[model samples]
Target: MFLPDAAATALLADALATTQPDLAVVHLHGDLGAGKSTLARAWLRALGVSGPVRSPTYTLVERYPLASGGEALHLDLYRIGDAGELEFLGLDDADARLWLVEWPERGLGALPVPDLEVHLGVEGDGRSCRLAFRGVAGESWLAALDERRRLRMLPEPSP
Candidate 1:
């Protein structure tokens, strides 16, 4: 879909926030300045992640414990030199209910398959977002999102 601005992007992210299940892997795909991080921050914030939501660029991974009782893992593999480096991130030990990963292509065969992939791209003065589902959880999440959007229960995106 075409997101007219950052606020529009945030609205989409918020809608997604309410539809996610207990366990989900989301891959955010986009080039630099494409608003990938903005969408991620908005999604995390909607999930009740208070405080600073810094980009995981340098740190590689950042964990946020949701007040709702689940955890969210935000990972940025932009600087990763090798897929083996992901091993130190200890993905196997991850107990996060939601995983948002950027630069997933860098992790390739090492990363877990994403339940849903949110692909963003620059389009004119705005951004374009495409949602693709992988597993059953993703299908369910998309169904919920469609229902919510269809019901017009979701808040309108800020201009």
Candidate 2:
């Protein structure tokens, strides 16, 4: 499935809000400037976060406390030179948290299995994304996520 830049972000944000406020994770696979960070920001906002959301290309991860409940960690592994570095970031939060990880492949063997995977790409004048569910509980998100995709990947309107 795919989405227009804004709608995709909104869709993802809405989907994240349905995860029951516990530990959830999204592993995003995308190229540079393909709206990965935009989606993260939108999702975080939906989680009731109000602050500057920036890429953690250097810090590896940034934790934001949600007003609704729980914490969300946005992580970017682009600058990471090795997989071993993931251990130092301490991604496992015993208190339960939601993780948004980009360049997930870079961390490979070190990360846990994601409940959902968001794969995006730069397509023409906009962006496209695909969401794959890895667990049964993710079906709700998957359904809503696909509903958004149906429109984005729909036929261009009378162009």
Candidate 3:
């Protein structure tokens, strides 16, 4: 999909709201200014987050309770120089209902394996996105997304 700017990215994020499974790990990949955080913020908002949704770049982790009654942990691993740093985030806990990770490569084996991966790249004045699924849950999410597209709940990505 080609997202022509932050707004288009938000549109994709909003579409993602319908496909939120009970628990899943999502790895968002992209370069700086590629709209990873924008999509994350939009997704959180779509989940009914009424408060601020700030990037976890400096803070490392941010927590949000979904309106549907679950907790989401948003993590930015950009500052993580080593996997050992991830231990401080208490990732071992199973309480997180959803995990949204940025720079998952930095955490590598230390982080939960992603159920879904959203890869974004700069394309012209916009971003190109590809969604990859790793497990049954991820596959289900993609299927749900496809259904949304078929039902016209999601706008087709620009060619």
Off by over 4 Å in 2: 19-21, 93-96, 143-159
lDDT computed for candidate 1: 0.86
Model 1 error, position 92 (Å): 2.2
lDDT of 3 by residue, 101-150 (tens): 99899999888789989998988888888878888888888888787773
Clashing pairs in 1: none
Model 3 weakest lDDT span, ten residues long? 150-159
Q: Any runs in candidate 1 off by more than 4 Å, and if so which?
A: 150-159
Candidate 1 per-residue C-alpha lDDT over 1-159 given as tens digits, one digit per residue, 9 for 90 to 100: 778777776777788888887888999999998888898999999899999999999999989999877689999999999889999987788779899999999998998789999899997888877889888888888788787773244333355
Q: In candidate 2, which residue pairs get closer than 3 Å at backbone N, Cα or C atoms, i.e. clash? A: none
Clashes of each: 0, 0, 0
- Consecutive 10-residue window with the lowest summed lDDT within model 2: 150-159
Which model scores highest in lDDT? 1
Deviation in Å, model 3, residue 123 alpha carbon:
1.7
**TM-score winner between candidates 1 and 2:** 1
TM-scores for candidates 1 onward, in order: 0.91, 0.81, 0.90
Question: How does model 2 fare in lDDT?
Answer: 0.74
lDDT for each residue of candidate 2 in 77-152, tens digit (9 for 90 to 100): 9999888988788766534378889999998888777888888888766677777777764676566555656334
Highest TM-score: which candidate? 1
lDDT of each: 0.86, 0.74, 0.82
